[model samples]
Target: MIETDKNQILLNMMTDYAKNNPDTIFCYTNAAILYETPRWEELPLEIHTVQSNKKIKNRTAITHIRPYFKKSKYKGFNVITLVDLLLELAVNDTEISAISSISHHLYKNEISVETILNYCQSQKQKSGVAKLRHLVSFASRLDESPFETKVRLKLYVAGVIIPVQQHQVICQNKKKYRVDFLFEFKGRKIILEADGLIKYSSNVNERANERQRESDLIREGYEIMRVMNHDFENGRFAQILENYGIPKRRYYGKKIVKKHY
Candidate 1:
């Protein structure tokens, strides 16, 4: 198991022990915690209950037995499987949040497209199965961050040509630079960067390295567009893409409510 904080350590130990018992199954966010999946939210203190034949008296854990439960082992530990965990998340969370969490696993190569698709296919007439199918179709293994996945999905939904994610280009000096998004339009190479404040401002060396990397890419005929989290939050990304010749396919027609005569 990966080294984590004290609380997480305690939670993991509890779940690990729970796996040994036959009556209870660790699941949902708790399953995710045990599996060490990348998540957008902080780890909750309460354990998520998947299945139990008897009442669990632990107050640190939340129990929900509504949706059906299944037990499986991952890496020799008995916990809820990834497919079931994803289905639960899809039913409970927003579409984007579900996609983002799944994307993190895909990006890390911890999960595969075929594996998810196969699992989704096995569950017929299940709630959230259709939505999971659609969401999984948009899942890209190349996304390095949640922001990158969001931007890529937006571009895809808007009918714009999807840029290559994490494209690596070798500079003249034999150094390779991997860009977040790379688009080739009308013979111009454009690079889109999702600039997070923590990544760029955490250290002077990091900032300097980024500057040098940008300068090298620019010298090699690459046009760089750096976008922060606020740009997407404020809905400025579409305009930014439009400025660079990406066509918008989504049309927002003016609302026309029917009037009573």
Candidate 2:
């Protein structure tokens, strides 16, 4: 829920605008909230009618579909401006970590860091430019999921060198596995695994398969570590890293404590 009164007022304000202006195409944050990333139900948005055929919305909800919620960047491709999206994210009273997660999706699928940074360069005087820039710094296309992105941000704060995402390693049986994170410290191969439940919740056998996979990696001279959602949230994984004797650039107590920590 969007707990801010200002955001509530904005949502009502935008909804009113959308109601009054039928056939309106909400742009930027407005469009983004209505379409792809609806973090809050009540977000202040500026609803505008781009074209009669583009989109139409009312007080009840948005209508006419524009998936991806972006302006066209290529021939017949629907794309949102990277800067616009990130800037809106920064101004929405959102936590930096949440904003980083959102930015990760945008970076992974829609835009490149160079492109977004170049665009940000032009928005120097914008209201949320500073926060937007910071959030973008944590954005990574390599993260396969939002949990990975969250882990990555914590790692950054802990001052650990970011790991290589989805790193492929060859095992003793001549099999190859794409690990979640990989770091080389003190000339040792350390693998950090983000153990999200969806990876194995569907079947009991998936868990067994995972253990076997880890066993294989260990047999081939790789030091392995695993973290679940709770470990990342509470920062307990940092202690595990210390216990394993991984070299860190900094000593952060209960901090990150992953290649992505």
Using Cα atoms with residue i matched to residue i, what is each candidate's TM-score against the true structure? 0.68, 0.61
Question: Per-residue CA lDDT of candidate 2, range 1-261, in tens?
Answer: 544554445456555655566654333323333433343224343222121232423422232112334545322222444456455545443343334444555644656767767776887888766666666656667776656766666666766766788889877688889998888877888888877544466677987888888889988889888777677556587876777676656554333211220
What C-alpha lDDT do the candidate models reach, one value each? 0.63, 0.57
Residue pairs in steric clash, candidate 1? none
Kindly list the per-residue Cα lDDT of model 1 for residues 29-82, writing each as its tens digit: 234434444342343332343433344455122232212224343223444556
Off by over 4 Å in 2: 1-82, 93-99, 233-235, 250-261
Superposition-based RMSD of candidate 2 using all C-alpha atoms, in angstroms: 11.2
Return the TM-score for candidate 1, rounded to 2 decimals. Answer: 0.68
